[model samples]
Target: MGKVSSAIINTENVYGDLEVAAKASGVPVKDVDVDILAVHTKYMIGEGEIQSVEDLSIFDNDEFFLNPELHIEQSYRVRYYDKTVTEKTHLPKIAIASNKTLTKIRAKILADSEVRYTADLADELENAINRTLLKYGFLIGVRSNNLKNEVRRVASLIRVNGALIEDVIFDVAQGIEPLEPIDDAMIYHYKNKVENADDPNSSVLSVVSENETIIEYVKSKPGRNGRNLKGELIAVTEAKNENAVEIKTTEKIRKEEDDKSIRYIAISQGYVSDEGGVYDIKEKLEVNSVNLKTTGSIEAGLDSDVTINVTESDVLKDAIGPGMSIETSTLNVQGSVAEGASIKARSVTIGGLTHAKSAIESVDADIATHLGTLTCSGEAKIDRLEGGSVRARVVNVNVAVGGSITGEEVYINELNSNCTITAAKLVVINQLRGRDNRIIIDIMQTPEYAKNLKVYTDEKQTLGRELHKLKANLQDKLSLINSNTSSVGYVKKRIEELSATGTEAPASLLNKLKDYQSLVYEYNTIAKHYRTQKERYDEVIAILQKMQDMIFDSKVVNKGRWVELNDIKFELIEPRKSICYVTKENELARVITIRHLEIAGEHIYEIKKSNEMPQELL
Candidate 1:
């Protein structure tokens, strides 16, 4: 038979009511006989569901489309399942095996077979439909609408009319679709890194402050998964943002991740940079020079974890601009520091001269040449010092023309300085020149020692007074002993004469002589006590002298011949507190040194000239 389509006769095949559905969907009905299965409903419902639909006169719906074959095959060779359809990234689809779809009418079958229909017949039809769907690898949905009612309604029609009827529905093929990512990851740069380092204007580098945000990273997500009708898993596709810029973090820049994004921040003050998707915050920075034209003043703070290296070596121009101040953890300058500039750091190194008006402060410093104000808590080494005011723990200079230097220990190879020098330990110079120089040895250094010295000095003065009193008492005692010596001899003679004669002498004379003898014994006891007190006084004096001995411990040694002299002098500071004071006025010598000496119970600081120098100072 040729392919045919049945037109409904008054009866409609929509899921709900025939009359209402025809009017709503704009279909012609309620005219032909022997109802034709021509009405098509987009959404299928349970059988006879149209009976209760109250006011569905103007409802609209959309129909999902799927291809159907020309005719239905009912043979043993018919294949119900199509395997060519597969699930895509976000869409899953399957094909229908047959062109026509029809619902089995239980009542029609009963009427044709001359058997009475019961509610059990509907159950049987549903069972059979389920079996068919299972055979085609379909697992969920569709059957939830309950096909029992559909079967019973068809059976009711057959019982009333006593004829078979056809119920048809077109099913659109659908399956589970895989989940897909919606957006891609992105990177945003907050600080633009220098692309070229060789640029001439890069004399002084620009740096980002600590804890500044460098980059913001927006992360991507992978969506959820899905399954198909065949019970197979569908994996989700990850989002790949091709246009998003990628920036990697370096060690100097720490990364912090939150619920949504990752942040790159500079942990130290330094040059922030990005190169080929790599982000870096460099703590070590190199600049050609620091001036108003090239770069502004850099004050990142002393503890900013930054090291700056100035590479400009021109002696004519300043490495640090005038009136500019720099404070960093470490600073190295190859060129001269200009006037009115100030530098403070943990460590400082200068390859060129520091000008007069500039000032530098550091824990430790090394300067090629210095003619400025400098204060160092640690050691300071200078190639040449001239007319500068410097103070440090230990000062070493190759050549000192003129400078006011104060240090615990000062060592100079060549000195033509007319400036004042104060050191606690000693000032040793290989060659001396110029005049108006006053090298002083500072005795008061450590506070604890100084305080103890003061106490001992007071004790020493008291002991000296006690010793003077003891001396006067001992002189009187000696005179008594001298005067009583003749009398004691005469009494001894008288006692011997009496003993020889075995004669009884007067008791009064003997008693008087005996009392006279006790006087010498008493004098002997008092002399022993005086000696002990004198020793104690000497001990106190020694302690006081040791405390003042640092002045003598310090010295000014001019090892080589004096090049020139004009009222040059060397003096021990705090003369009263020192064990001995050294003095020199316009004294010219080849090798001048102050020596501590004891001559005739007197302390002396002897200034002498010699060629030999101390081996330790060498």
Candidate 2:
């Protein structure tokens, strides 16, 4: 037998050619055998033989090979040689085996162009590989360089998963410059871009994120009725000034440690504590008003005025403890104050009743207390004050009982008899005269009243001196007028005698008559001067009398309102007895007697009827 050459063909049409060649070579056609080898590397490795073709047309020439027998030993040897070469190339074998599986995936990814290979697909591939490798007593080491190279090569043909794509995106993100946050009304779209670093035409861009925001503006879109709502519309605008970003979130998340909820809304520049309290306001904290509903207290720092309104009762009891004080520039409290709580501020006003033992001190304080003491440097207006002392520059009380009130001006609608009142200027009580009430009116000894009295006395003395001088001048004028009148009468009698004589008298006699006539004129002039002086003297006398009356009135009602003691046997404590002004004969007069008076000093005085006075005293 000669050496037979064999040629492998991947098409089924060549099988008939081999049969005809064998028959023409004097070999029997029945000896020709055609074998089709499936071109898949999995089937090519195990048996070194062709598998059966289930469907003839389904097998493509590129995926299947047709092998015909030459019957010579050389053709058989050539077939064995080609199989050995295919089995030794492991990389190409793996690629060829996975090609059909990867073709469908690549086509799917390329169809969308933006489709990303996700981590789930990569995980499935890893799991399948692990399961297959484990059955062969081997494990796929993910960290191996050979596997990494193979995966990169395979991914280049197909599409890498999302995990790798995300890595690339992150790298690009790190290189990008950070952008300033925009707070205006605008639309922004963030895109993922792939650019050839070298070729601008190779760039691709796709949107990754999009955002739209709205802000306030002056002129905005019209409403449904074509009417411009005052503050409802929003317009597109740009930020004018750049400042540090401030994020104000109204949704407050309370800490787990706190047992209560605190809500604070700030409309101005102010600092709110994490615990929901406002303090340390640099400017005046002006809101509609501060209203506390629960158990909370507000404290304004120095120079900050605060107006607090608490509608709930017993809410401030725990906040304002005994001896604890709330101080502010101006404090306005509309709730009841706890007992023994002291408040010191520039101005304090309490709309509710203050409890007992609470001391309030301010420049101007207005409070209603059951038994709280109020000390105001300026003015105090109290309502229903009972069993507490009040000392202020000016005090006005609706009702006072068993409390010592001392002020420059004190006004009480109803004063209990057990209360002691001391006022420098005035004390007015509608209902006075309860037991043991000490009403002390310090008048003459008071510096303010004493100064006024001194002024009055000096004026009266000066007026009296002017009156005496005028009277003296008038008296001299009267005397001169009387003398001139006598002279004038004598001159007039001589003139009449001369006229009756009707003869040419001596020049000396005529001159004497003329001198007498001049005397008559002088007398008339002196009479006119005397009358004018008498009128001035009378006016001065009237003024002097008025000043004397005023001096007496000043001793009683100089700086304070004179009390009308309405038949009440209440003891009056006065600095001087004469300071009491009593009504007698429809006129106000100083007390004259010490009868029925518990006098502290020797100047005690009493009031008496017109008939009760002694004959000499009247």
TM agreement with the true structure for every prediction: 0.44, 0.31
User: Lowest summed lDDT over 10 consecutive residues: which window, candidate 2?
Assistant: 167-176
lDDT tens digits by residue: candidate 1, 64-88: 1111111111111111111123111
* Alpha-carbon local distance difference test for all models: 0.60, 0.42
Which is the leading candidate under TM-score? 1
What candidate 1 gets wrong by more than 4 Å, as runs, is 1-248, 251-254, 265-278, 301-305, 445-545, 563-612
Please give, for residues 1-618, the per-residue lDDT of candidate 2 as tens digits. 012433344432333455655565444545443332222211132345644333323222211221112010001111111222233211111111112111111001122233344434333333333333322322123112233343443344335442223211000000011123343221111111222323322211111111111111122222221101110112223433332222233322111212221222233322232223322123233322232332222344334444333332344443344444555566666556666676777887776676677888788987756467788878888888778778887788888777878776677777664676766545555554344565554433234555765665566566567656656765675575566666656766776777799855567656765765665566566556656655665665565445333332211111112234422121232222333433322333322222343457554345432223223222
In terms of lDDT, the best-performing candidate is: 1
Q: All candidates: CA RMSD in angstroms?
A: 29.8, 37.7
